[model samples]
Target: MLPPHRARRAAGLLAAGTLGLSTVFLGAIGTAQAGPTGWTFSESNSPITVPSDVCSIEWTITGGAGGFGDTNLRGQNANPRIVTTVVAPGDQYTLVPGGAGADHAAGGQGGTNTVGQGGGANGDIATGGGGGGAASLVLKNGQVFLSSLAGFGGGAGGGAGGHVPDSPSAAVITDFATTPAPGVAGPGSITGQGYACEALNTPPPAPEISVVPGPGQLSVWGRSGGPLGPGPGVAPVTGYEYSLDGGPWTTVPGGATHGMATPLLWLTGLVNGREYGVSVRVTSSAGPSAASAVKKTTPFERPGKPTGVSAKVGPSELTISWSPTAAPGTYPLTGYQVWAFHGDEVDGFQVYLCEVSASVHTCTAEVPAGVDYAVYVEGVDDKGNVGDYGWVNSAVVPLGDMPATVPAKDADLVGASGPITTVTAGKTVVLKGSGYMPNSTIRAIAYSTPTELGVFVTDENGEFEVTVTIPGDLPAGAHSLVVTGVDPQGDVRHLRVDVTVSASGTATVTEAALATTATATATATERLPNTGFSAAGPLVAGTAALGLGAGLIVASRRRPSA
Candidate 1:
């Protein structure tokens, strides 16, 4: 047989013994016999080709960086005559491809690799996933779908000068090998991930902030995060602020020490209730981060009860209802809401039943019958303020039904999921003042109860809005709530809630049953008034105040100044 090197010679390629060119596979294309190491090639590699087109080059795929940004394998340094375009194989990435560090400076290295593959030409970032070289691949017929694992390595990035092992089995093409088909060979590797040189001191994997793990510190899993030495230009990580269950956001102290390293929990803090997300801002004492990843955490909150609820009796043309807001408030009474599981009542519920001075306990809705539905109600004060939905069970309603009720006097009722029954304060929180008459509403000062932090006054829709930053200096401990809501009719609504504030400034409200919660945290929140709650200091907005008053005081209070 002709010598393996001489068996597949093509026009314009370096013949054997010229330029130290050796025979190597170029991923999906056939092989070219050049010298020992001078990149033996016949022609440039196209991103794709027609199945009927002749196959000529060799091909190989390398692993790529794990996170978002792109990685490139520069072609400038490759055999100048050979043009290559790398098609990320499986879950590949290509950020700032080619060049040593960036397009602005340096050129990339060449070879096969995987996570952490291709390195910066200057070794600015870590090596590509497989440490394998990258090549841009062109799909034939345009119908090939790459595996999720097919990732892009930094294009010929820099600093990959060390001895990295390479695969030995590459297909070499003769003028006759691809006559019947296009030049391509694959369906090769069998795993989603692989690596070339795996002995380096890898950093502790970065922490994951997805909804699955429930945000906060200690959410470590996947990739890299810790004390491992920094990878090129990595910014030193300090602490981070995060949110939970989509509540207020605040940053705190804590992070891995390796500077310039890739940390999942990098710059941003955790937020509650919403799908988590992050952007690692690399920083050095020299300055802030230059390269950032605008990536959102994978959301994994459990499915909630079917939402967008409305009720109709068909006979009265009355449609009673409520909405399940994504707002981060406590249950039993999210704002002015009251709820009962379906089928708990034989009759539908009435919006209002009792009416007395100062107290709304007499205000109850009768449960309708025949149809399965939950019931709830929000208390509206005389000043037009609405309270969280309070629970009532004067009667029960079954599926597809309605019950009878004798007419009660002068009570106005709106059907709904209810109202914002209860919400605990963050170290600092926005006070939602709604539902009060324009000029007649009370100040946030009067409604400032701990368990019941009064927000802004109501609007024309009887809904008011206010953004009050909860101070971070309040005492940390398990506490209860007491709030008062005045309506347009001058009636006051009372509410009681409970919460816990950790020493590190993590605030969480407990459920009505007082169950310990692992979610819903607000770092900075204002204190609600207790019986002796002395009006502490005046409300100073936006300052990071870390000290609270000597004692808890009640009204005759100091108003929170805007």
Candidate 2:
């Protein structure tokens, strides 16, 4: 009674619904038949297998139970209700179970003939016995995630040993929680639980550190507090951080090898005489711990040497001066040392003359006259550190009173004898002189252009003879010679002389003559004093001679005549 097309469509829809229901029923039945497998850990380790069809698994893990001890001191319970998730698991895995801690025995009474029992060989005798920590549970060949508080185990109390007269009874000690069973796995959802889970995700505990003064003022030591133990759950301290004088913190890269007994870190480079505050902290994968208490210290160092040293010579004292040292601010200069030593003498000794304040750079010290002296200066710091000596400076002091200037009348200049008035250029002239300071130096300088000709030292009697060569370049004319003398005390005397220069090769000499005439008158005024026939005799003789000469002339005339 229905249409053919409509009836065929309705029948097709009903068949499809029936097939869908059957498929769902078969899937449910299969799932119900394949239940989750269970496993218990009796040995230290065991193997676990996952079903091939299973895609994920939920795990509940707990640590082993603790042991019992005397004085009602019960062992601690294992970590409880730890939940974890494993995704995509179809392979074998290894499971490790924790072992329970051992129980402690109480001490027995001591007496002769009856041995007394020793204290329990577990934990401290007075305090409750300690419980062993739980081992970690690791899942392999599968992606596993743990909830908070999944790895921690409680610690056990110490057992009471021998009873003491005044001490509290051993029964007063109370028991802690009992240990828990090992972990189990099943096909179920894994959800994080408990307040401890939230705590486990937080950063690890910070380490404790202490700093001590080292051998040198510039050095310090950093010590780390040993391993912090609350069970296997807490992370260990890995490295350290330090700061000096309120400076930025510096981190040490490597972790400590000995937990609480880590070696001390030797730090250097601290400035001397400077106040410093140091601090340190611990670090781990979870982050860094808070900074430790600050430690204060001061350093010391030697000062630098002084520079720019100089010495000024006086009649009886030496004035030493120097520039301020470029000392560091940490070790400021406190004073200066002035030393005097004999020139060219190193007897391993020096004269420490005096000390001057830092504000002053110069000092005066008395010295013997006529002696050469070498001087040095050094700087001293507050810490008793002395700097090296500065550069050496030398000076000589004058000895005695200076001689007076020679008077022109007291000195003379004379040339070698015959007509030696003239001199030629490039010829030697010998001269002599006296009346100068004995044992003094004399210099002969030409007047023209003030050129030096020669030098000589006066002998014991203050007299000298010197030969001087007229310079070829000297003008051929008259010139003056200036002579000077210098005594030991730096006094000066001078003398001057005039001389002429000639172009002729030889010296010329000249002579002059004188003539006289007399006349007489024949007046008989108290006639001339008696002379032995002088006047008349001379007249007669002259007449006779004349006659003879006349006669002879006549005869010659006649004889030229004979």
Instruction: Compute each candidate's TM-score over C-alphas.
Output: 0.20, 0.22
Tens digit per residue, CA lDDT, model 1, 1-562? 1121221112211123211112221211111122122222111322222221222233332222211112434322221111122222232222112111222123222233232333322333443322222322212233222211222223333333212222222122221111112222211121111112112122222332321122221132122233333443333333433443344444433443322222233222433333444433322333333322334543112212223434433321123344443332211211222333321122112222222232222223332221223333333323222332323222212111111211121222111122222333343333332332222222233112222234223333434334443444556766543323333332333233344667776656553422222222222222222121111111112111111122111111111131
Best by lDDT: 2
* CA lDDT, candidate 2, residue 190: 19
Count clashing pairs, candidate 1: 225
Local error of candidate 1 at residue 177 (angstroms): 17
Q: How accurate is candidate 2 locally (lDDT)?
A: 0.41
Model 1 CA lDDT for position 539: 16
Which 10 consecutive residues of model 1 have the lowest summed lDDT? 551-560
CA lDDT for candidate 1: 0.27
Per-residue C-alpha lDDT of model 2 across residues 92-172, encoded as one tens digit per residue: 545434334344453311111011111112344344453332332333543222211112112244422211121111111
Best by TM-score: 2
